[model samples]
Target: MRDIHQVHTLTEAVLDPILAREPAAPRVTYYDDATDARIELSGLTLANWAAKTANLIRDEFGLSPGARVAVLLPAHWQTAAVLLGCWWAGAEVVLHPDADADLALVTLDRVDESEGVGEVAALSLDAMGTPVRDLPVGVTDFATAVRVHGDQFLPRGAGVALDGMPVAEVLAQARKAAARQGFSEVDRVLSSTPWDTTAELIDGYVAVLAAGASLVQVVNPDPAQRERRIVSERVTAQRG
Candidate 1:
């Protein structure tokens, strides 16, 4: 067996353990509507989705090991899958703002044009159907990239280090934050904010996923009803 040092990406680390686990275990749950307040996913589903999407990322964008891929998406199950997929493929992921121009510019400067960077992918969440523009040279729509790449799981190096104070530890801390926000096995998550929103970043995105709960994103939810739905739906988690 190869050592953890031989491992190359986040995707590899997450998927391997998930695959090794029993299929009956809960892994991921996708919430697209408000009908359900409590939802959970099995471990098998999360592993399969991560593998499929990771394969798509690899084949479509030609993402290589240690490359950085920026994500601009809402807080949906697909978003989590893609982020993990990128990591599985050994690519670094930068969460980017969905609408702020200044932040977008800063993110671009920080991530784009850097040497050893891989493809930069964008996701359009505009309700106005506005055209996406001004993306960096290699930037492509994430959906298009996935569609172009067939579903296939190609294993990479060993996996990420489970050693002292590693990235996984950081993820664990994020999970603890989610639990503090009320996320539990029986609760489903809904976000009125973007996935990259600061509040969602610290509390909802990583935390909800770590808690193994389903997540839903309301792109244009009414501000008045936002809190009501969150409470009624038992959305234990919030972007705080």
Candidate 2:
């Protein structure tokens, strides 16, 4: 049997259990412009999308295992999904507002300029239209990649269920399952406070995404809007 130390990536740890579950079960929720979009992500869909996106990164930028990718964007459900996708592809993700340049340098491979900076790419998120650059290497526009790849992805691995289940119980089950699968300590993440305070991310997100029930990231502007987000989105976690 493989020991916890042997596990290498987040995809290997969580995919099987998720795939075994029902698709209609709610996996995550996001709030945009006062509207909430809840995704009932089955294990199959999550695994497939992550794999597809990972493949896109691999093929387009030649990112290998252990490469560092920086994602500078808001904490939406899709952002979380993309982070999982990066882990699935065997790469480390650096969240936005990262201040440690040395830490960022360890495995830096591709940087999505549309989100922030570290490297340059063809994609830009500016609505007013910024001038495009013709760079020789290291930059990518994530939106374009998703567009080119299309929405459908091939599924991989078996699935599990934590749907409609209490957060605590789901976490316990996932922890036991992950331990059996040989996933130990993954990373020490310092997420930008308040938003990162949720039990879901610390308990479920990081533990399930990274190996060994450990790991994890940011943001500002809008107090009244933030309050609405908490109430509408059901974010019961404490605000910093």
Candidate 3:
């Protein structure tokens, strides 16, 4: 077996394991109480999104490893694609608004109002991955732009280390914590936590990927629907 760390990119380490598993299995399911939206992604479908987004970042944006990208969207299933895609391109992800970034990704509703420090992209996050109805003046439609790219990517270079910790170290730490928390392939995790902090970074994103478990994410959750989701999704663990 090839060592994932030998690949020299965080994307390779994080995605390689998941790709080795059942591609047809459910990888992420998202529910939005405010919008009454539900979207589910199989491992293969999620990977396709990641690959296409990575190509967009690499080919269109001309961003190289270590370039920072601000992901200004909510915790929708599409956010998963963006996060994975950024790592796949060997770029760093910045969720904080104040952070410096070379590119900015925002929700379609926020496109006209957003002032990009550099390049801007709009994500519809709609059930059908539709393009925005009224695209902002300077923003590219993410769903439309990514469609032309192929569904396979190979990073051309290695990513730079962040704060003395490389991507490999981050993955290792998240995997260790996930293992200690009893997360595994057989478990289905329900994450109600907002993806706005460090804990959410490790627990919500990295841990689920590391554990090879499916994630059921709730955005603007409703208490009444929680039990129904837990039962329907076969959730074995809860995090908030």
Q: Among these predicted structures, which one has the highest TM-score?
A: 3
lDDT of 1 by residue, 76-151 (tens): 5556666666666655455543231111112223434333433445544232323345656655544544554444
Candidate order by lDDT, decreasing, is 3, 1, 2
Predicted structure 1: lDDT: 0.52
> Candidate 2 lDDT, tens digit per residue, 1-240?
323233345555555444454333334433333333233344455555566566665566665554565555345444555656665555555543343211121111223222333433343332223433443354445555544553343323211112222223444655764455444443222223332333444343545443422222223333556655555444433323
Model 1: ten consecutive residues of lowest lDDT:
98-107
Q: Per-residue alpha-carbon lDDT of model 3 for 1-240, expressed as tens digits?
A: 443334467666766777787888889999889889888898888889898988999999998877777777878898888788888887777665533577888887655444645788888887787888877677898888988998898876545423334587778877986987789888889987776665567778778878888899998899999898899899998888
How does each model score on lDDT? 0.52, 0.43, 0.79
| Per-residue error (Å), model 3, residue 79 | 0.5
Which candidate order results from sorting by TM-score in descending order? 3, 1, 2
Give per-model TM-scores.
Answer: 0.59, 0.50, 0.88
Task: List candidate 2 stretches off by more than 4 Å.
Answer: 1-6, 33-40, 96-139, 150-204, 207-240
| TM-score-best of 1 and 2 | 1
Better of 1 and 3 by TM-score: 3
Which TM-score value belongs to model 2?
Answer: 0.50
Name model 1 segments beyond 4 Å from true.
1-49, 74-78, 96-118, 125-141, 152-154, 158-166, 197-199, 227-240
